[model samples]
Target: MDMTTQHITLGAINMEAENPVELAAFWGTVTSAVPSVGGGTVYLPPAGPGGFAMFFRPMAGPRLERQAAHLDLTVPWGSRQAEVDRLLSLGATYKWDVLDEVPHVQWTTLADPEGNLFCVAEHPPAS
Candidate 1:
């Protein structure tokens, strides 16, 4: 048995949305991921090269509970503030800004419409 061989390929995102369509739309616009499947759960198709697929699952939870896990997005230098503002305009709420005072800088924290945290970072150049 090999460690690499035991790993299964699966990717998804859990969401608590009153309306899945609207929630999917919001994510779609932000990530440019289309809905690959619909009905019980909505799947957002993959984006450009190097991008991965996303799925939305209904969760029975409130919008204010703190999340132990979240998505971190990193924007290019000097782009965090602007991108944060843009996300705010597009149905996102500003939770708090985080920075590593010791290491200079790191990332900003933001949450989506469903209160799910995701970061808007500088798009890394394709290697």
Candidate 2:
């Protein structure tokens, strides 16, 4: 099966938010994306040609349930703590410690301002 034969290409990953502008700005900073708005929704340009990007749309509802999918962010090798500190200062909340709960993993679970969960870890150094 030739996967390229499938015409479907991922355009973006979108998240439902109460405030699309705010969430989009947060995600833009997180991913270093160039953010733009269209039809009241936010779009972030991909890092490169044909790369998958991000979007955020407004949603009105009660409290959101835990999502099965979450983001795993990486920092430069050995900078996990510093990155976590920076994100925390930028309005991210500490959720849980992976090493404390899982015993070996060196990741920390965190939540964005809107309570969307994500993880931050150190990227392995280049060989």
Candidates' lDDT values, in order?
0.70, 0.79
Tens digits of per-residue lDDT, candidate 1, 1-127, equal: 5557565544556566767777888888877778754676787876776565677766666655567777766667778888788888889888776565334455667778867787655543445
List clashing residue pairs in candidate 1: 73-119, 74-121, 74-122, 75-121, 75-122, 76-122
Please give the lDDT score for candidate 2: 0.79
TM-score of each: 0.73, 0.77
On a 0 to 1 TM-score scale, where does candidate 2 land against the true structure?
0.77
lDDT of 2 by residue, 2-97 (tens): 667667787788788888889888877776677898887998878676456888888857655768898877666678888888889888999886
lDDT of 2 at 79: 82
The worst-scoring run of ten residues by lDDT in candidate 2 lies at 97-106
What's model 2's lDDT at 8? 75
